[model samples]
Target: MKDLYARHRAVLPDWLALYYDEPIELTHGEGRHVWDAAGRRYLDFFGGILTTMTAHALPDVTKAVAEQAGRIIHSSTLYLNRPMVDLAERIAALSGIPDARVFFTTSGTEANDTALLLATAHRRSNQILAMRNSYHGRSFTTVGITGNQSWSPTSLSPLQTLYVHGGVRSRGPYAALDDAEFTAACVADLRDMLGQSRGGVAALIAEPVQGVGGFTSPPDGLYAAFREVLAEHGILWIADEVQTGWGRTGDHFWGWQAHAAAGPPDLLTFAKGIGNGMSIGGVVGRAEIMNSLDANSISTFGGSPVTMAAGLANLSYLLEHDLQGNARRVGGLLIERLRAICAQLPVVREVRGRGLMIGIELVRPGTDEAYPQAAAAVLEAAREGGLLIGKGGGHSTSVLRVAPPLSLTVAEAEEGAAILERALRSV
Candidate 1:
């Protein structure tokens, strides 16, 4: 293991960070559990950062991928692809955007890149609005719109990016405001930004629940409120659902449903969980905006037969079994249990997030300051107690994230919560 770690360090880029003080090489997984290279088992609460939506090694998805692989795999966009068409049709129907059209990509970065292209081309402007503490992706175009300074490596960008208020509900200047006032303040801020803009803003892209920003979220109607203003100015609203899509939130199939009052966004970008780790990402938008590109564009591996088959199977299983309902029941119990435990832990600041996407922010005892070291200590202790979770936040990376697969059993939720409780106590 030491030699393998040394080799990984030597070969991999330093920016690609691995978790834990002693990183474990995951060998195999089943359902909600995984075994490390040394054969130690753990309840997988993070699900590879919430990519495995249904479960690890799900039989349906596995069979689908294997069957497709046996037949054929690669087919570029120039050719006719049956599986891609089927999946695209399904996504378009699911997508709330009017006259929606789906375009496939292999990663969230490319998906957001496509959305930027559609928005800029449709609106004929390069100005963009993004929420504070929000993360889109790491690509050159996506990074420019990302609000998180930690994730964004460069300031040079083609677009004139404008930072907006309201992704973090519990911190910042609007933290003390009530939900109604907070929504109003953010909308007013947006109105003011639009009034001062030099060019027509192409779009306002946001995460319904900021994923890499530690699962932070605003009140339900914040975007609905923003939508009212954006529509008046012909600015498009894009929901980056890479982390918040596919019924993970339990209450809604898409995170945008929380703000359904104003109708769906003009564009919705999805990745992460849909392919169940098969590398599928795409954008769903109105046909007019999606077809705005005059020149041809194609993703070489975007909708490979194998990945599309996996995605179709995974999505079908999720809906047929009502994993969204499972998320609600099990996630509710888990959050209640964690909140009770956190109430007693002084170092734990707040427990937040909807359904399976949960976050526990650590802070200095009796103070509001972020306690990053406490978060690190808890992460190490959690691993020792035979559980795996993730950590992230816009402020100091002080939040512990717990987003298990949608099919997580109540028993598994209880077990993971118990282990996390012990880890926190030790911290």
Candidate 2:
């Protein structure tokens, strides 16, 4: 493992961060458990950043991929692709947008990039609105819109970007406000920013539950309030559901459903979970906005047959098993358990998040100041106790993220929670 780690550092970009001081090379996985190079099994809570929606090495998805691979795999968009069209149709129907259309990409970054292009072209504007402490993706265009300074590497961007004030309600100017008051304040801020724009703004893109921003979320209906204002200015709303999509949030099938008064966003971006670890990402939007691009564009590897098959199979399993309910029940118990445990731990500043997408914010024992070291220490300790978790937040990265597979069993949840409790106590 040490030799492999040294080789990884030698070849990979230094910016591509790896977790842990002694990184473990995951060999294989089954259900909610993954085995490392040393054949040590550990509970997988992060789900490869929530990409494995159903479970690891799901039989249905694996069989679909194998069958698809045997039949055919690589076909460009020029030819008629049944699996791609089939998956797109399903997504369009599932998406609430009127006259919805679907376009596939290989990753969240590309999906967001395409959404930006569509928004800019449709609205005939280069200006965009994003939320502070939010992370969209790592592409040059996505990095530009990302409000998280830690993930954003450069100031240069093709479009004019404006940061908004709603994404985080726990640690912002509006933190103290009640839910209704917070919504009003954020809406006022959005309108104020719109007034200050030089030209027309194309769209306002946001993550429903700010994923890399420690699963932080604004009050429900906040986006709906902003939607009302954006509609007045003819600005489109884009919901970045890369992490919060497909019932992972438990309460809502799509994160935007929490703010359903506005019907739905003009555009929605999704990735990570739908394919259950297959590389599949896409934008679902109204036909008018999606068809705004006069010129042709295509993703060479997007919506490949194998990936689409995996997505179809995985999505079927997710829906058939009603993993959303599982997430809701299991996650509720897990969060409550952690909250009960953390009540005695002063280093835990807050336990926040919905469904399986939970975050534990670490702080100094006496101060509200973020204690990233404590988070790191807890993470290491969790691994030592045979559980794998993840961490992310603002610049400080002080939140411990726990988003296990949506199909997590109650027993597994209890086991993982006990381990996490021990780890936290140790830290």
Candidate 3:
């Protein structure tokens, strides 16, 4: 294995250092468990940073991909494809957006990049406002708008301005500010920024629930108020649902539905779970806004037949199995268990997030400062205990994010939580 790694490293580009490869070489996975080459089975609680909502090697999705591969693979985006059209229609219908326009991409970053471009093109503006600590994508433009400076070393273009806002857990009791006060303050800030930019603000991009920004859920009524402010400024609201979409959020098919009366975003970006590990992503937006782009404005491997087939099959499985309902049930159980465990542990600061996406924040015993080392120790201990998890956020090396596949069983959830509790105690 070491030799294989050395060989790959010799041939691969040095820039591929973004991921820290584990010692285990995973051979296969089923449900919520993955096996390494050594036949060691590990419970996967991280779910590829919330991408594997349907779990690995799902039989239905596998069958669909296999069948599609036996037939046609790629088709030019210039022509209409049945699978692409079907998946688009399904996404629109499920999202409650009538006559929504869709544009496909190969990954979440591309989906976000396309949404940003479309928003700017539709609004004819050069400035973008993003939530601080929010992560959009790694592309030049998306990274320019991403709120975390630690993730980027390149100098940002003057066209982008990020508003660093506090997350619910980070803001403590103040996290639940009154809707009117929160709205007024956020609107005033944006208004000032817009004035300084001479009305060049194109869009205000956010995550319905911040994924990498510590799995933070916004306060109640925040989304509606934020949307109103954006509407007042003629700016588009782009919801980056790359990590939150595809029924992972439980109550609704989309994470934005958790916002309730906050109203829908002008544009929504999705990817990750849509294809069940296959590369597929898309942007869904209001018809008028999506149609503003030229006929041939954007083109690439957007909606290939294979990816579309996988996406369609994945969606079908979600609906047929009622995975959204399962997410809610299992996620609620996990959260309740974690909160119960936290009640006895002073080091456990907070357990926040909704549906299948949850984060356990580890802080110092008597200080507000995050205890990143303790968090890492917890993760290391979990891994030693045969469970897998991941970390997130700008200030959250302290956050252990748990986003298991939606199909995870109650027993599996209990087992994972038990292991996690043991790990925390050991750490």
Candidate 4:
């Protein structure tokens, strides 16, 4: 383990953060459990940052990937790939956008990059609006639009990005307001931001639930209200579903559906779950917007047959098993359990999230000061107790992120919760 860690530090970039004081080397996984190289088994609550949508090593996805690989693996976007076409067709239908067209990518960053491309080119504007305390992706262009200063390295970007309000509902300046008034205040703020833009704003890109900034979300219908204002300005609304997509939110298939009154966003970006550990990401948007690029473009590994097959199978499994319903039912119980436990803990500030995507904000015992130390301690304790979780949030990484696979069982949930309870107490 020491040798591996030394080698990793020597070979990899320093910014690529690894969890734990002693980073783990995971070997294999089955269902909701994974074993490290040392042969220690753990209940995987993070699911590789929630990429493993279904269970680990799900036979259906495994078979699909293996079969596709045996037949063919790399047929770039230049060819007519059946798996890609089939998956695209399915996604287009599922995507609420009318006359939708799907463009495949290999990561959430690339998908969001494509969405920005389409939006900027279609609107003939390079101005963008993003929510404060939100995270998009790690890329030259994506970092610019990212509202989280910790994630974004540089302010120099191709597009002019204006940070707006309404991402975090509980801790921001408008936190004290009620739902309706909060929504109105954010809409007014958005309108004011647009009015200050030098030219027409291309689009407003937002995450239904801010993931890396913690599982923080605004009041329901806030985006719908914002959408109404954006529409009046001929600005597009782009829903960044990288972390919140694939029924993780429990209450809705897509997090954007919570604000369905304004209709679907003009464009939607998805990743992290559809591939079930395979690399798959995409953007679904109206045909008119998608076709705005005058020049030709293609991604060499985008929509590869193996990944597409994995995605198709995974998506099928999710729908067939009614994982959304499971998320709603099981997640409700998990949240209730966590909330009940957290109410008695002074270090815990809040337990916020929907369904499987839950976050526990840590604060100083008797004060509201963000307590990153407690979060770190709890994370280490959880691992020691054979439970693996994740950490996020903008408050110096003071939020514990708990998101397991969609197929997580009731017993597994209870086990995880118990382990987490002990970990929190130990902290």
Candidate 5:
């Protein structure tokens, strides 16, 4: 492991971060558990950064990928493809957008980049509004829109992005306010920002829950209130559901539905769990907006048959198994258990999130100061206890992230929670 880690550091970019002081190379996974190279098994709580939407080594998705690969795999968008169209049809129907059109991509970054392209072309403006402490992706355009300075690599961008408030509910200028007042204050801030900006702003792209910002989100209907203001100015709404889509949030099929008073957003970008780690992603939007571009565009590897097959099988399994309902039932228990455990611990500042996606924010014993070191220690401790987890935050990584596969069982949830309790206590 040490030799491989040294080789990785020598070959990979410095920015490609790895977890733990002594990184473990994962050998394989099954269900919600994974084995490292040394044959140590662990209950996987992070789900490969929430990309494994269903289960690891799911037979349905694996068989589909194998079968599809055996037949054909390299055909691009120039030719008609059945699996791509099939998955697109399913997603378009599920997407809540009227007259929806789907454009496939290889990652969340490309999907979001496509969304930005469509919005800018449709509205003829390069100005965009993004939430504070939000993370989009790694692309230049995404980096510019991302409000989290830690993840963003550069300030150079093609679009003029305006950072907005209301993404993080537990921390901010309006944190002290009640839910209703908080929502109103965020809406007022949005309206004021729009009022000050030049006319014809293209769109506002936001994550229903800020994933890389430690699973943080605004109060319910906050985006709906912001939607009202955006609609008055003809600005489009683009929901980035990369990490929160496909019922992971339990309460809703899509994270944006929590703010559904204004109906669905004009455009939606999704990736992560959809393909179950097969590298599938896409943007769905109204036809008018999607067709605004005058020139043609194509993705060489996006929507290939093999990946689309994996997506179809994975999605079918998720729905047929009622994994979303399972998440609600099991996740409720897990969160309650953690809250009770953390109530006595001063290092735990807060436990926030919904469904399978949960975050435990760490702070100094009696103060609000972010304790990133404690979060790192807890993560290492969790791994040592036969459980694997992740950490993230806007405050230099002070939040522990837990997002196992949607198919996680009650027993598994309880076990993971127990392991987490021990880890937290150790920290």
Candidate 6:
């Protein structure tokens, strides 16, 4: 393996150094555990950054992908494919948007990029309003909407901003405003920005619960208010559900449902768990916005039969088993346990999130020392204790993210939380 890494390093470009590669070579996974090349098993609490809604090597998804591969594989967008249409209809029905249309992509980034483009085209605007600390995707346009400055880098030319503000959180300065006040301020800011741009604001994009932005759930009524403001301004609301969709949040099939918003977004993007770890993503939007794009706005690999089959199977299994309820139950248990743990640790500032998507924000008790290093140590200690977790947020600060597969059992949840507790103690 060392020799293999050396050989690959010799061929790989230096630009790949941006990634933090783990030392282990993973072979396979099942349920909630993954085995490294040396055959050591680790409990997967991170769930591929919330992508594996079902689980790794899900039997149903695997069989579907296999069966689809044996049959037809690729079909041009010029012709309708059965799996693609079926998946689209399923998504539309599940989302309670009968008039919704689906546009497939190979990854979350592409789906978000498509959503942004469709919003701009349909609304005929050049400005966008995004929540600070929100993460849309890595594409140029999506990155512009993303609020994390580190992702843009110093050398990269900054995308011209429409507007951005911090998400609803207690730690930020924006926390002073109550939920309604914050929403109103956000709306007023957007209105001002749009007026400044002469009605050139295309959309207001946000995550139902900011995922990579530290799992920050918005204050109550915020999303609903934002939706109303967007409607007033004729701006599209784009929900970037790349990390929070596919029933991971537990209360509903999509994260936005947690907010109890009255109307659906003008556009919504989903990836990650849509195909149960397969490289499949999609943009679902109102028919008007979806149809605004030209006929050539599709990739050769997008909506391929294999990916469609995997998506269908994943969604089918989720619905048939009612895995969303399981996620809610198991995740509730984990959150309760986490809150109890946080109460005991001075470094832990707060615990926030819903369902399987959880975050533990760490702050120094007395001094200004942020505990990002402590968080990394906790993750390393968790790994040693047979659990795998991940971190997120700006500065890669301490936000211990727990996003296990929806199929996780109560026993697994207990074990993972125990590992986390032990990791916290060690740190």
Tens digit per residue, CA lDDT, model 3, 275-381: 88899988998999888987566455888898899899889988899999999999999999989988888888789887888988888887767888888888878
lDDT tens per residue, model 6, 1-427: 6776787788987555421245556789998899988889999988777877888898999999989999887885767789999999988877656488998999989998888888877877667788877787777777777776655543242334564553746656567787777767766665666667654578888898887777987675577776776677677888888988878888877877755665777788999988878888889988988999765555788888899999999999998998989989999999999899879888887888888999988777755456787887887788889898878776565788889989999999999988899989886
Positional deviation of 413 in candidate 2, in angstroms? 0.6
- Give a tens-digit lDDT track for model 5, residues 4-62: 99899999999899999899999999999999999999999999999988999999999
Per-residue CA lDDT of model 4 for 1-427, tens digit only, reads 9999999999999998999999999999999999998999999999999899899999999999999999999989998999999999999999889999999999999999999999999999999999999888888889999998889889899989899999999887899999999999999999888888897999999999999998999999999999899999899999999999989898998999999999999999999999999999999999999989999899899999999999999999999999988988888899899999899999999999999999999999988788888899999999999999999888479999999998888999999999999999988
Model 2, 163: alpha-carbon shift in Å? 0.8
Sequence-dependent TM-score of model 1:
0.99
**Per-prediction tally of clashes:** 0, 0, 0, 0, 0, 1
TM-scores of all candidate predictions against the true structure? 0.99, 0.99, 0.93, 0.99, 0.99, 0.93
136: Cα error in model 6, Å: 1.4
Between candidates 1 and 4, the one scoring higher on lDDT is: 4
Model 1, runs deviating above 4 Å = none
Instruction: In model 2, state the lDDT of residue 259.
Output: 94
Candidate 4 — worst ten consecutive residues by lDDT sum? Answer: 390-399
Q: List ranges where model 3 is wrong by over 4 Å.
A: 13-22, 164-169, 172-184
lDDT of 1 by residue, 355-422 (tens): 99999999899999988898899999999999999998985889999999999998999899999999
The lDDT values for all models are 0.93, 0.93, 0.80, 0.93, 0.94, 0.80
Worst lDDT 10-window in candidate 6? 152-161
List the pairs of residues colliding in candidate 2.
none
Candidate 1 has an lDDT of 0.93
